[model samples]
Target chain A: MSTPTETDAFEVDDSSIERMRFYGRLFLGACIVATLVGIVALIALVFDVVVEAWGWLTWEFLTHPPSYLAEHYDPSNYGDLPTGPGGIYPAIVGSIYLIAMTAVFTLVLGVGAAIYLEEYARDTKLTSFIEANIANLAGVPSIVYGLLGLALFVRAMGAGSSLLAGALTLTLLILPIVIVQTQEALRAVPDSMRQASYGTGATKWQTIRNVVLPEAIPGIMTGIILSLSRAIGETAPIIMVGAATSMFAPPNLTDPTGSFAAMPMQIFEWAKAPEDDFQHIAAAGIIVLLTVLLLMNAVAIYIRNKYDR
Target chain B: MTANGPQTVTTSESDGATSDDAMTDDAPLGSPRVDDAVIESRDLDVYYGDDQALHGINMDIPERKVTALIGPSGCGKSTFLRSINRMNDLIDIARVEGDLYFHGKNVYDEDVDPVALRRKIGMVFQKPNPFPKSIFDNVAYGLRVQGKDDGDVEEKVRTALERAALLDEVEDQLDSSGLDLSGGQQQRLCIARAIAPDPEVILMDEPASALDPVATSKIEDLVEELAEEYTVVIVTHNMQQAARISDKTAVFLTGGHLVEFDDTNKIFENPESDRVEDYITGKFG
Candidate 1:
């Protein structure tokens, strides 16, 4: 009923301080050790990749196309391939086409699904069922997606060995990731932002388009970048959809069936060959792939930092 | 703390039976009720799922006046305030019962478009949430989205910023990102963005609760000034703030019931209910 007197206020406690210090040391030491291990592993991985691939990189190597039968460098001795260095010209083009188409399709379907789930879907049995399936799909192996692409696009749809099949499969592979990231981005926007828009008499869609999406742009971009990088590095699914090893040129969208090889499948094929020359060539291809991946990842990091405020 | 619930204690002393007797005696020459109040509610109730959050409530919010809604946490003061603008419709499980009128038109009417309604009534949130854009862009967002290109958007942005009392601090840095400002400046920037649409009313939910004393006072002063041009409704937990800045105050209690509504002076000095008296007197919330 009464305030504490001076005598009561002066009572001190010392026993708990030592225990708190002990816990603090334990937690801090664990964090420091974990961070150090992660840094060391990343550095070692980069060193290994650079050392193995350094010899395969050269101006001619990047600009030239692959030759058959491990013969002499003379063009007259080989199967008269395209003018460029066994340059991954076709693979590079295919990768870009594959990634762009995948991104567009995924963005529409993934973001749409996220908005529907977040704004309209109540926590009903149907919504819960869909959510559980999405989380599980994110965990499904990339190779499985490749097989699905092979069956659905290559066989049933009869779009075998084409960029279209590759893109459609990649879209399926990344759809769950895009949806999850978009949902997280949408959720991070403060409820107050939505309230402010609604208070202004903004309609649900208007509020989302005007206020909610603007605030969520940085997050959405981050998700897009991450998903795109993943799509670029993917090799199994494209091979499943039949990216061939011998295609010397890029294919148009409407052209019928044709085998198209990507950088990863080429690298994998060359790496497994018996000849040392092919091994070095595959290592160079790996180097180029790594460079593209690095650039894409850097872009992702830049976007996240640019709008992180 | 005082053993009596704060609202009950405050209201008991402020109005109690004496003021009611006094009010009843004035029935023959009763106070004139303004028919054109900006927001009118009758038997308004709100529920979150099966839980009833707000009980029946009736009140008329006069136009161009600073009306303050005060209550303890979870008392549904914000809920009632949000209902005026139909902001509760955004919440998935939130359901409202009863009629809410804005300019004599029921906002819940099937024909009413909430988006159009929102364009006419802007809002500032408790914490400053400026779009991650330049100061000019943040201010021009509302107008630009509404297809308003009446002239130079820059000039209009400047006017809105000036009205929010933020221009002097930010005019030189219109291109700078809104996040670069200090907390108070950012809050004002949000206010500028809210007013850019020339909204008829502005709803502010605890706009000053997150600021320091100086920033809080600045916001209070801004609210007083804004009342001259727009119907300003603010919800605050700070009783002193309500007493200081608002012309009218509505006191709310537990479970979202409005206990009393009157002139600020009357609510603080002579409230009509024991619950309101207890609340303002620093007893239990």
Candidate 2:
């Protein structure tokens, strides 16, 4: 195709544009390859876990509390011999309670902080410093958060070996994710929408409540789902907060101050018990955890698509 | 004719003696032959940070009349229009120095409430910005914002739509999203929204610039009809639009000077300023 004479005034030579197109395609290919690599690893891991654990997953296995099969508690010999398997009911209940409590605290705290930062805070030096610290805090290791929970919630708060401490630990570990995503959600709302509201004589809070909040809700919800998934999967923080691997005497689900066992801790204990049946139960537990993560991600994607319209 | 039996300007020779009025200049522009001037500015200056936008603007906008401000790009025409209703207050760096008197009250006074003031003086922006709501809701926004839930909301919305010439087109689909309407229809919906609150002064900032030729003509006619009720001030780059619809025209030239303010016929037919004549004649590069 030939270019029009009139277009010559505005259009640049095609060579540079062609070069940019080539680079764009190259970059797109590279990104797809990276994504496929991650996907392949995930698929292989899930397949292996499913094949190994499918037979062990049963109503009975899920309903009964796990117990040791060996005659004695020999740490060295346990790994070499076969151990009988029980259920993961207590661990599942404990995780659900922990995650539920974490969501309640983290959602309220994160969304409120995000709103203040995005809407009310002025672009001053102190605000920038606080923002920089929050970004840095998000990158800190989950283990550090575990230590913090142990120091603050477990010991100082006098909630020894309790679900409350584990919940608080998970909440802290995921709070930064929630805040960052919520802030981005609020920021994605165009300034024009706010201006239109103001032009109609609406006050600052009125505009935010009426226009900005409605538009930002879906994004904030997506953030919550993603953060909660991560919280549910955390093990170190729960362990540091005094979550027990073997809750010999299981506590009630609502017992915030009693000892708890999460899926990770239960699975970790079972897989190390030398019994083939315990290893099968561990694989089954992994499959259940992965399914929960997948479901949460799906829900997040659904919310994002609904809001994008 | 002005409402109070005298326009902001006076008869050529006799009333020129009145030197107390700050806006009254020595060079006679013309007698504002109308009844009353609803809004008047005296030595009004506008600034965006350190940059001076408009300088020494003095004019009386006659009540229920169309006064158009025309200028080249960056010549402060839009700035002047925004200043009338204190819309410039939205900009952080924008500052107004001189007095803008509306119905003998200075809006810039410390005691004046800007939100209340905005309700009385509505505005329509250049691009149509209808809310992402239903057509009925968009028209009802102005009233709803004020918590006016009187049973007559339906009647008020209908009347506003009728006045804006959008009722016939959108009456059947009041529940449909405002964004679903055509460009021209959305703009008319905006007009209905602005007029729903029953403001006395309505400012249009190139309200028809984004539409097609047919839509532009329709808006021009709507503007002329609007001037019969509310005081209308419009800023436009289209010279013919200013000439066709306006009662009085203020010619803002380069260097932020309003070179001429006179009857539209006089300005278009026989302008007094050399620069205004050059601009009207398309002599500028």
Candidate 3:
């Protein structure tokens, strides 16, 4: 190919410029439409759920456990509950317990693994292999993790379809995501900071603990919160790990090896029921789940903003 | 030379010669030294991976004086400076060969920890890199890292900032973030941080290259003042800077060879090598 002459290169083609501008606008329009598709669908779904749950989302509905007989339900008979169609208080409590446990387990394991990989691991084939495997694991189906948890925690450890088993399953499901995000957070800290610490005669661990970790904490916190939000919404893994669809009482917070129920599991059961009232109850349950997720995201944003510098 | 002229040392006395003596014997001759040398390198070679960055560098830096390493880009001046404190150890590909002595002890010996070596030799970089913490914390970082952060931390930090010529500007705002300062203030903050640990020597890699003219002059003044209390080795691209502030100047050429090492006046006005003269007169790098 020959290079363009100076004169030819300097000359601007108006038609071609117009055509390029038109194509750029077309691409922008396409991107806007693509974005609006997801946003509109989400808004429509949320609107439908709010409308259906408007009458059912009451203090009684929130504070009482689910009951079988809605017409005969009475506040005075609260001692003997689950006989009348009441609320999803037990499910909410169970979900919170599962998420909290999952958060602790995943945070410890994920941050530790990330620190090892990013800070200590040498650049070799073995480390690259481990890194690649972790990335791949993040993309694996949640049900596969559920099976692993079922085999390891539920059967081998004899946790017996309890809150421990469910939380462990969710932990496994989101561990890879947490690890990957934590690695990103750690890597985002500038190498200059590490050099500064080391130049001051700080040992390797001292540098990491003082300079690296402090700078990375905000990013790590955001990653943990986002991963916890994802884990809280996971239904299939919890189901596979044997979360109860309905419960009269919340799981014992101090006892890990006890029966549990989760919001998604309760919603699934309610949505599956033939009664229309149960469907409205499921919608209300969805609203509660969404609110938890929104709160988690808000916390993540707040942390990122507060400590961003 | 005047009575208080730059301390000049001659390296051509070939007595007790080793194989490395051949390289240093060819180096330019200069006046006799008055001050005791604090750091010495014998036929030091540095490599980044398989590429040699410094070739047979041999010199002794005098105590309590500013020694400037000046060269064009890619001449390994920075590499030599980093080698003194083993800051190059941070790079996995970097390798060092030959003896680098501090107080008659070879720093590259097996038992000498790089961390311990660095405690006595602090560094400042080209860019002003103050930590994302308060100004007091930034200056106190080095002391805290060395576990010297006891009751007198406030007094030591103030002295450090004062020596760095930054205390007057930031006395009331010690709790403000170091990153909030201007470029010159930040560089001084870094200098204060380095001095807070009370290191015997400070290595600076083009510390004023990124600053404006006013900031650069301020840094130049600080460097001269620092030499009163600590030995300082600096790398610079500006020949004028090497002349204006340095007591001794070592000029490395394009091939990572130390072409001339002498008193700054001699190196600038009457270099022994034609290439050095050419470089000084701006005919060629």
Best by TM-score: 3
The interface root-mean-square deviations, each candidate in sequence, come to 2.4, 1.6, 0.7
Per-residue lDDT for B119-140 in model 3, tens only? 9999998888889999999999
Q: Worst ten-residue run, lDDT, model 1 chain B?
A: B23-32
* Residue-level lDDT tens digits of model 1 in B55-154: 6556778899999999999999888877777777777799987777788788889998877887888888889988767999888878876777478888
Q: Clash totals for all models, in order? A: 37, 9, 1
lDDT of 3 at B239: 93
What would the TM-scores of all predictions be? 0.83, 0.83, 0.91
For candidate 2, the per-residue lDDT at B186 reads 90
- State what share of the real interface contacts each candidate retains: 0.52, 0.26, 0.63
lDDT score for candidate 2 against the true structure: 0.80
N/CA/C clash count, model 2: 9
> Tens digits of per-residue lDDT for model 3 on A1-309?
157788777555768889999999999999999999999999999999999887777677677787665432334554565455488899989999998999889888999999999999877899999999999998999988888888999999999899999988898888888899999999999998888888889999999998999999999999899989998889888888888876889999888898998999988988888877677778888999999899999999999999976
RMSD per model, one decimal = 6.7, 7.0, 5.1
Q: Give chain A TM for each model in order.
A: 0.84, 0.83, 0.90
| Top candidate, metric lDDT | 3
- Please tell me which predicted candidate would have the highest DockQ against the true structure: 3
Residue pairs in collision within model 2: A82-A275, A83-A275, B1-B34, B1-B35, B2-B34, B2-B35, B2-B36, B3-B35, B3-B36
Candidate 1 regions off by >4 Å? A1-56, A73-87, A253-257, B1-36
Mind giving the per-residue lDDT tens digits that candidate 1 earns over A7-106?
7674445457778999999999999999999999988876776776565566655555565444332333335544434555566666777787788888
